[model samples]
Target: MPLPRPLAPTGRVAVVAPASAPLDPADAHAGLSVLRERGLRVETADPAGGPAAYLAGTDDARVAALNAALARDDLDALVCVRGGYGVLRILDRVDYAAARAHPKLVVGYSDVTALHLALWKEAGLPGVSGPMVASDWGVGLDAETEADFWRVVGGDAGYDVRGPGGEALTPLAPGEAEGVLLGGNLALVTALLGTPFLPDLTGAILFVEDVGEAPYRIDGMLARLRLAGVLGRLGGLVFGMFTGADVAPGRPTFSVDEVLAHYAPSVGGPVASGLVYGHVPRKSTLPVGVRARLTCGAEARLHVLDPVAA
Candidate 1:
């Protein structure tokens, strides 16, 4: 993974609704307040308004806001306020040249995965795809997740990521591997198939997480990756929190672990289980474009090899 440029205090950070719409005022207020309290300047393209069905506004409006922020001299970074849906609508609409020219941190996850891959593959900029302003920043973050966020953003070196000390942290393939970290929401990743946006995962550490999807859907998406020759190319794999996949009523099916074994034959890389990310209550912020080492031993640790830019 390439190192992210260091984020200094007083540096300006712009908030835009890249995926969903503008955030609810309450969520916005809390997130903005947190950013301000952390000693950074905060600006939003949405102001304090909500649009129809509430997406920062329209595709054009959201794109305009993001582009405007990119061009701004005061802003040092761009953070997505929330991620519900809508990024694909404006994928072609974004100005990659303008965004690359400015070169600032673009952060968010879920639907925002589309933007993360675009900014990296299209603009060649590294971005965080772990937490959203409305989700992680404003809300109270768990100690483990919070610590990991600052460690990465601050460019801390050689750290270990342990699972929530429980039986939940079981190995799938069991081994160690090093490669650039790449991946995000499972749905968004599969959706990018056959598009210019789907990144080349060759020799990359593919990390993925999702929320509220059935085990079969997760299996199907992984199957798609295998068919597309993605899984075969990865150097390593990490599975973040696969939340809300409880068995459906009257549906006797395989567990997430069972699904993992089903694809184990096709995956060539050393795979780890239970990463502390995804749509869970608290999660670490991850830079998708940075290279890192993933060790799956008694514990799972992702040691970032890229320096946080000085």
Candidate 2:
């Protein structure tokens, strides 16, 4: 995996709305301040307030804003303003030649996942899944979340990330394994299953998270991965927060935990839940296409085995 150069404390970064517009101007501004507080030079690529039909802007507009950012020579990285439902539409519009020509970290989660996958396929560079200006940063990040996010993006040395439940992981499937860290939001991951954008997860620690999905839908996506033979080649599975996935009484369905319990064991490698990376307030960041290790036991922790950036 090719890691981009690690962003320095005062590195230049651009914020762009590649998916949905920031719902609130203040939230977006506040989120940008978070990056500034991290000692970064943050700039907005385009007006995040630009409106469209459920998009931050028209497909061309969004693509152009992103391309402009990617083409810049002074930027050290790019962070998204928000993620909703437009990145896939502009995924192919990315200036791959420019992106590959000047590799740097691109950060976001949720619908921005499509962009990350597209970058991997098109630019052959990995991305960081962390706080977005309108979401995680605007809401507020706990110390653990903020530290992990910066450490993954700014530092050169890899570190260990223990789940919330110390001593032992919340749910552990015995064994230890290492592989390239990959995957993000469950919905986006499933959406790209049959697409050229999806990377080959031959032996990757596939971490997944999602929100507002029912238990059955979550199970369905996981089932799709399994049926697609995607899970069979995994070195491990890191189950992150699946918020709003509680089953309602109306439908007869297996619980999210049940679904994971059923599949994690079958992966035949370390499996654990409660990773602090998802659509949660206090969440950590993951570097896609980088080496990671998972040790399942009383002292289980996901260790970033390699630098995500130079």
Candidate 3:
């Protein structure tokens, strides 16, 4: 894990729209208010980059905004406006040299997971797999979610993450382990499997989550990971809510739990599910590539060893 780059109060953080354009421009504007309320100077591109198809802008435009954000020394962090798709198209074009020279916090989840995998491999750069501006910030963040979001991204380190209601993590397989915390959206992770961007999770406490992916689709991706020897490299396995992945009543399909039964054991270490870490309204802020310890007990707890910012 890299050393922390803690963001001081009132530090500047740029907002970049690297994925799809915002569904609601109102949300983007409100999201800006949310950040300003945190006492930070916020900068953003014309997030209204006049949609070029489904993307916020043409491939080159999105890449330019992100790379430009990295090149600036004034910014303490970078946050994505939203995530839909299109990151892979610009992955190869993003030059991380400038980011590597002066590392700053990068934040997003879902499609941005691909960016996390790429940046972590290219520059050992760390990012927040947590709330996004339009995604959570504009979705009416609750007291607890807002508090947790600031604590994690505000440069606090070594805090424990647990399931909803502060419940113990329920293990599918029992044990304890510790390693760099890595992983994000399952679909994005699956898409990067054979690519150079995939981080080598040799001793990683790997975690994954997704939304609307059916049971068989999840199973197929997990199977691919197992065959690629991805699962065997994990120090532990953590699964967040598989929102909307459930099969409908009377449908002849395997349950999400059933899919896990086939692959969780391949992890060669502890495995826990129902972790509140993805695709939900109340999302946890995860610092990519940070050292963390996972203890699977009657309650499972993960403690991030490094702060997100310097």
Poorest 10 consecutive residues by lDDT, candidate 2: 162-171
RMSD of candidate 1 to true structure, Å: 2.6
TM-scores for every candidate against the unseen true structure = 0.90, 0.92, 0.95
* Poorest stretch of ten by lDDT in candidate 1: 161-170
lDDT of each: 0.75, 0.82, 0.83
> Candidate 1: deviation at residue 79, Å?
1.4
**Per-residue lDDT of model 2, residues 1-310, tens digit only:** 3457788769999998888888887998888888789789988887344779789888888899999888887888999999988888877778988888888899899998888877887778889988898887877777777767778887445677753323235646888888888889989999998888888888788888999998878888888998999888888888888898776677788788887788886677888987867887776678887788888877567888777788
Indicate which candidate wins on TM-score: 3
What does the lDDT read for residue 14 in candidate 3? 88
Q: Model 3, 59-145: lDDT tens per residue?
A: 888998888888887888888999999899889888788878878888899999999889989988888888888988987787777
Instruction: Rank candidates by TM-score, best first.
Output: 3, 2, 1
Clashes within 3 Å, all models in order: 7, 1, 6
Query: Which one is best on lDDT?
Result: 3
Q: What is residue 58's positional error in candidate 1, in angstroms?
A: 1.0
**Clash list (residue pairs), candidate 3:** 5-309, 5-310, 6-309, 6-310, 168-299, 169-300
